[model samples]
Target chain A: MIFIVLFCFISFPEQRNINELKGTISMIEHERNDIEIMLDNVGMVYDSADGKEVTALTSVTMDIHKGEFISLLGPSGCGKTTLLRIIADLIHPTSGNVLIGGVSPKDARLKRRYGMVFQSATLYDWRTVIKNIELPLEITHCPKKERHERAMKMLDLVGLSDFADHYPRQLSGGMQQRVGIARALALQPEILLMDEPFSALDEFTREKLHVDLLKIWRKTNKTIIFVTHNIQESVFLSDRICVLSPHPGRLSAIIDVDLPRPRTMDIKDTPEFTALVSKVRNSFEGV
Target chain B: MKKLKKLLTSKFFITIVWVVMLIAVWELFAFHVENIKRTPENVQPHLSGIVDSLTSDRKINGSQTALQMVIENAKATLTRAGIGYIIGIASGFLLALFMSLSKIVEKTSFPYLMLIQLIPILGMAPIINAITGDIAKSRIIIAAILTFYPVATNTLAGFKSVQREKHELMYSYAANKFQIYTKTMIPACIPYFFTGLKISAPMAITASILVDTLQGGIGLGCLLSQSLKGAMTRYVFWDIVFFSAVIGILSFYIMGIIEIMMCPYRRTGKR
Candidate 1:
């Protein structure tokens, strides 16, 4: 009976992986009610007629520990978006697999455990700032009064409480993105997947929102997977930066940023921040 | 005042001036030309007696009686047109929504709807009467058919043209299919639907009037026809004038209200 149970447990994954990537995945030890997103030798390939079969992600294995701010840093078309999307359970991988808290993407999604912010603010223009931020709650069927109070608190966290009544177009790019972040924070999910959420804003606005985002992340303590091409921005915001190389993206390096807590915009001027930025940049160039 | 004057000095002002000039020229042609005169002789009137009865007592009745008669007729036509429009638009929206959400609906009903629209509802009036047993009701149905395609096409375009990334964004928030449709897709398409409404609005008025003329009743169209048949050209002219004014008022207000309610994005930029 023990042998039969073990055999069933072992074959469980093999059967489930019939529609998934044909590779192996091992569960990571989840420390708390936090995220442990583990991608095990994750490879994604798209089949073409000429058999080009572009491998968008190739054996890109990485783990995001609980309450960690991780940046998947790469230039455009580096499959960073694809990888982030994989983590979010948005698209099923053609080759590899992902896990959030020892569970598959499907399981993670079914638990209402992830939130995403797109490159564009992706704010519904028809919706007011509060309404847009209230979207996640509405989706998850959060009660009206509590949802409003939480949304207001989130907008306060992003320092846009005053702008809650405004439509997306009424706000600047930076303000729009703040609303996006607030919207993501509405559910207070275990993981926040941001695909270059600040890239649309100007440098000043991006830097400001980075400060805003970091503050909110620390307060909420959710695992954040930030995707960006900006080296400084990634180094500034991320606790660990995962350097990626293009032309079939593969993880080049994962460097832990040893910068201290309650990081401010002033930290960007420090030697540690610049040094870490250069280190991540060197890793990219070294590839 | 100064800013208003400056606004009146721009190319926009010049364009408006040109439009007004063109309208003036058109009105001049209508007044002076042999073909389009509004005299007692140009076209036979429907009920000069009704107008004379209604209008001649302007001093005795405080203009509210004629206003009331005009209002009552306008209200009747408006009610029918309004209800018919709602049904047509609602059906159009449903058809478009069904067609977009599934390939089955698209395949089975979409082409047939297009073909059905092609059969002129104006020409199909007698059959509609036979089916529904009332000519006025038939006219409303015909008007609805005339207005159907635009609303359907616009709604379909709206639903299909919803940004895929927006769908992803909604999904990330754990939005279901229904929420996605109601919140994201519907609102996104309101402006397009309004544009489609603009295209079909005239078809509604014209088709209903045409249908009403085909089978007489107690509408503005019936009044116009009645005046024409009785050789009361003045009354026909007046009825036509009254009908046009009523349509103008309704089209402006109804669509304006819809635009205000559906799309606040427009308000942000302009206001």
Candidate 2:
């Protein structure tokens, strides 16, 4: 009886360990399957004012993962913004499919799964900073108390809690954009879609915001699909840079940025960061 | 000293300075006309005479004092103008809103709106009078017609002035048409709406007074026309002119005040 008991006790942990190993392997497989947004051969064609068909995007296929910071990097007219808009369901793709978490982009938008930030702050001048942050919540018919609480939390997250009552015009351009970011974050969406949000800022403000954004990204762990024409910005901020080229805008390359975590403005001076930036710039040659 | 400097630079104080300078110029001009041109007192009557005409208890039309007559007529004209101004602005804004919503509506109606503006107010007045067949109603209608163009055009322009990116931002939230207008378009168009009001305000007052003058009615315009016929009543004419100027200035400033109240974001003074 004593020998049998000892053997059972000894084998219990070993069996458990093997089971735990299997569980982790399955978890890894689940993570691999967890594509947050899937754009499969998506295309956008606009009918120009002169009645000519303009192809904005051609055969763009990409998969954005959960909690990953990805950038759609390209120059103007590369359809990067158009792609972002398609993902936000602001504009429909002329061909192919876009799935957001196993559902159509339209359905995901209807479910409020996306929080979008534009190049300009786009804050309504009539609404104060806090009220602007509260806009999406208001549209969703969130209770007044919860709406206020969530807006304040978002304001705190962007470090603009003190500017709650200030009007958008009263704040500097950078501050206004921060308020814009807070407004987007207030939605608590599954993904954040930014369309060249920092392109307008001065270089100094831009670098500062980069650090702040990475911190926010780490803290929130939300998947971000940033659209930018800037190479350095994409290299500094994104986990993956999806390089695009214009003239029937199509994906040219996808460069993985393996920069160390908690990256700062200091990384831009590092050779690794410079190499990544050059790689993105060089990827444009495939046009 | 700082308070004094601030007060001197204030808008009200600046307006006062302008008034004083203008009066001095008027006094000089009056003196020149009286002494150098050798004109009679009734022609370009002196400021003192205009003041006397304002305060005098002499009965006008045998029922009202000069001051009392001016007040009654001014009140009647301003009231008609005010009502018509309000109506015109409301309808203009509504039309503009509709025009903005549909390109078809805009294309069809906008040209006629321009045509309405091209028709001289004098030609349009009699047509309105013929249609209404009542003096008071025609006066209101004429005022409204004159006031409509600027509000409609300016507000329409305001609606069109909304940026494409702003529209996309609203769509990103899955906002409906009504929400986009109420939350974004209407509030943004406010400054432009006020600009329309500022322009249309004087036109409304002018239209009301012109209808009265042309059609012959119991308002300041009629009083001026009657006074113009008799040289003895020229002082009263000058007084009416003074009162008309006051009404126009008052309405303009009142619109400005309303604009300030409505658009608090426009106050960039602190920065």
Clashes of each: 9, 0
User: Lowest summed-lDDT stretch of 10 residues in model 1 chain B?
Assistant: B40-49
> What are the lDDT scores of the predictions, listed in order?
0.77, 0.87
Give the per-residue lDDT digits (tens) of candidate 1, residues B1-271: 9998999899889889997896677555554553554453343332434357456545322444444545555666666776777778888888888888898988888778778667876568889899999876876787777677888989888888788778887776666789988888888888878877877776677666666667565676666676567634344446466565558557856786888877767787522
For all predicted structures, in order, the TM-scores are 0.83, 0.89
Measured on C-alpha atoms, candidate 2 has an lDDT of 0.87
Cα lDDT tens digits for candidate 1, A1-287: 99999999999877885434432224424444344887878888887789878888889877788889999998876788889888888788886657788888878877778887888888888888999888888888889998899999999998998888888898888888888888877888898989888887888888778787888888898989999998988888888989888877888889999898788888988988888888888887424
Pairs that collide in candidate 2 are none
Top TM-score hit: 2
- Candidate 2, after superposition: displacement of residue A52 in Å? 4.0
**Which 10 consecutive positions of candidate 1 chain A have the poorest summed lDDT?**
A19-28
Off by over 4 Å in 1: A1-28, A31-35, A48-52, A270-275, A285-287, B1-27, B30-40, B43-54, B57-76, B111-118, B261-271
